[model samples]
Target: MGIRGKDRQIDNIEFNVNDISRSKTFYGSIFGWSFVDYGPTYIEFSDGRMTGGFTTGEPVRTGGPLVILYADDLDCTQLRLKAAGATISREVFSFPGGHRFHFIYPDGYELAVWSAS
Candidate 1:
């Protein structure tokens, strides 16, 4: 299966943490999430029905986890977000599985949109 059927849907949630192992241990013990390490800096987690990730690539944030959405066409989605008053916080960047960009919505919540490469 691919992301073709999940266009514009809430896809993954991500957290920036100081320690990936600690986060994995905590979530695994508390919520039974299973994790797959990508490298020293990142790990993917699955809680049965949903998937997310923890990364040490960024500083530990205080507000909340980043909510990510999937788009079949990243550029189109970005344009729509911009026209809806979102501020592009980060330009598109490639990760392991896809490319994504960050944005801040009107109320100051940061989110991301990704499309599979």
Candidate 2:
């Protein structure tokens, strides 16, 4: 194989829920989403092509829903997020060859969609 620096890709996305059972039930009932439980507080679902995990409230809501977005350029992604009314919390910063931003939605909930640039 030829030598390469790296390739950017998304592993998965996560959504925070105050109630895991309720949320899981809702998704399963509505969209027929199947789930795998890591524990009582965690559950994962395959919502269409998107795969996301759910975490129940145990510690606290330090942030909000986390919707993952894969991109080659995190800076460009930041611009789109800002335009969409997401309040910037963490700016684009390179860390170990990746960049990410944490922002709050219009609902005053914080979430981050990270990308490796």
Q: TM-score for all predictions? A: 0.95, 0.48
TM-score, candidate number 1? 0.95
Best by lDDT: 1
In candidate 1, position 32 carries an lDDT of 93
lDDT of 2 by residue, 7-41 (tens): 23444667777888998889999999888887877
N/CA/C clash count, model 1: 0
Give per-residue lDDT, candidate 2, residue 31.
93
Pairs with steric clashes in candidate 1: none
* Global fold similarity of model 2 (TM-score): 0.48
Q: Which stretch of 10 consecutive residues in model 1 shows the poorest summed lDDT?
A: 1-10
lDDT score for residue 78 of model 2: 73
Task: Give the per-residue lDDT digits (tens) of candidate 1, residues 39-116.
Answer: 999999999998999999988778999999999888988999999999999999998889999999999999999999
Cα deviation of 65 in candidate 1 (Å)? Answer: 0.4
The global C-alpha lDDT for each of the candidates, from Candidate 1 onward, is: 0.92, 0.68
Tell me how far the alpha carbon of residue 43 in candidate 1 is from the true structure, in angstroms, after superposition.
Answer: 0.5
